[model samples]
Target: MVLTLVRYIREKGMKPGDKLPSIRTFATELGVSQSQVRSGCLRAAAMGVLKIVPRSGCYLADVTLSGIIGPFTLLFEAMYMNVQPPLIDLYELKTTLERGIAKRVAVIRTIEDLAELKRLLDAMETATEHAEMVRLDELFHEKLASSTRNPLFFSLMQVIHSMLRQSRLSYKDFVSEFPQSRKDHRALYEALRDQDALKAGDIAEQHSNRRKLLLVKNY
Candidate 1:
């Protein structure tokens, strides 16, 4: 049912935040019971694909197809077009890449890289919204990747972030840990500033572990 609704949405070219059709109308058109349509909408909302308001009905989430699917949306044409890689699988890849990339970046990062990261840290401190917080967090990691001077790792980081975005936002732990998260980021920055590769990698691993634990529990 979620796929059916998504198909209907894509066909109509609905924009983010656009109101979804009424459950009765959807049931009539999609040839499903209203209860079934409601159940599907609820599941989609849980998956972060739609927003359900008590008084306002359902609406499309602010997620794009490319963002919801993966960053490699335009990168290739694969046979499993309808399949999205498992969220845990993507998170595992991200965790692995970040650990190694953090070490390399610490050893090779330049003053310019530090400056950009510092700026992002400052912005993150002032960000109050969950969406903005997530955006800044992703940017902070992206900078770390770019600082490594390795285009492959940098591109992979982008893909990982894009694909895992919804997963990141689904958990309240992502926003609730803001203060501690800042300290984590600062620790990594300090490690980079001191060119301590081991320390940077350790911090990255610890950070990923915390998120991984929370992700598994929540998911």
Candidate 2:
């Protein structure tokens, strides 16, 4: 039901914050019971795809190409696959992506890109909460991917970051080394600032491997 509602919203060309049709309208057009439509709306809202207001109608949540990746991944797992990708597989793919991002971003990054990355790192320094630290770290790498001026790269990194977030929650012993990670981010930022492609690539790989070790060791 949730998937059906999602498809209906997409088919209607609805965007984030746009109001969906009335439940009665949806039920009549979709040939579903009103109760089903209500349930579907509730389910979709739970998935972060819809926003239900007490007095107003359901609205689409903030939409992004990256935001849809999580749903697609789960749909694939439930419909076509038996299990999620192993941690090692996710690490390998992310490491490769980071290596490539470092190589290109070092050469392609503009002054503005560097500044944004530096800004994220500076925020990391002042961040007091664990969740804030993790969110900033995600944005840091997302900036690296975006600095490459490749939409594909940025979208892929977002999905990987999402998956890694879930993985982190599952690994009870996978404590974060935010301090060391921040230092690595500083080095990466410097490498990009210097336009040192080779050094940036190396540091990116090393950083990925360090996390890989921590994850597996704790697993």
lDDT of 1 by residue, 3-88 (tens): 78878999999999899989999999999999999998997787678899998899999985445544233232232246764666
C-alpha positional error of residue 73 in candidate 1 after TM-score superposition, expressed in Å:
7.1
Q: At residue 77, give the lDDT of candidate 2.
A: 46
lDDT at 39, model 2:
95
Q: Give TM-scores for every candidate, taking all chains together and pairing residue i with residue i.
A: 0.63, 0.63
Residues 1-219 of candidate 2 have per-residue lDDT tens digits of 888988887788988889988999999999999999999899777767899999999999995766666665555344424556577877898899999999999998898998899899989889876667768888999989988887778777877777678666566543357788988999998999999999999999999998888887776
Worst 10 residues of 2 by lDDT: 73-82
Residue 196 deviation, candidate 2, in Å? 0.6
Where does model 1 exceed 4 Å of error?
1-81
The best candidate by lDDT is 2
lDDT of 1 at 137: 88
User: Residue 184 in model 1: shift from native, Å?
Assistant: 0.8
